[model samples]
Target: MLFQILLTLSIRFFLFDFVLFKSLRNHLKTKGYFFRKLLSCPFCQGFWSGLGVFLATHLIAYNLSFLLPMLSFGFVTAYLSMMTTAIFYPLIDKFEKNYSTL
Candidate 1:
């Protein structure tokens, strides 16, 4: 469970906060105002990344172990990762602020 959360969190951070995707994000922004807005919001990023994580882990678990439950793990993980990512975003922001010149 913790691994899922952290993996989801890292996915969100990489997609939205990392500098590697700066060009992609800019292209997305140019595509539409909504795309730009979604890319800028951690909550939105978290939701999408969370869902992605859930689907990935779910598929693996479902195929590997025939004991997967009927729980809404996808949505549950989405919300959980969303909330956690939002909570941790400020710390990430602070790091960028402090070392943006480096």
Candidate 2:
């Protein structure tokens, strides 16, 4: 569980940070409504990434026979991840503001 959270968070931050760095960041975020909504929100990032990680792990490690239970647990995990991302988003913001080359 802990590992899942950390992995999700790390991947979230990487996408929310490094992947979007440089000119492509602003371009993609502004190009389409969908891209804007997806890229600009920490909650969205967290929820999708968190749920994806959970489901992927379940598929890889076990069978999908417990799909309903896994979905419920994954939803809870995603919620937790969403809150955690929101809480950490500002800290990352501060860091970027202080050090960003832009």
Cα RMSD for predicted model 1: 4.4
Best by TM-score: 2
- Please report, in order, the local distance difference test score of every candidate based on alpha carbons: 0.69, 0.72
RMSD of every candidate to native, in Å, equals 4.4, 3.4
lDDT of 1: 0.69
Check candidate 2 and list the clashing pairs.
Answer: none
In lDDT terms, which candidate is top?
Answer: 2
Worst 10 residues of 1 by lDDT: 64-73
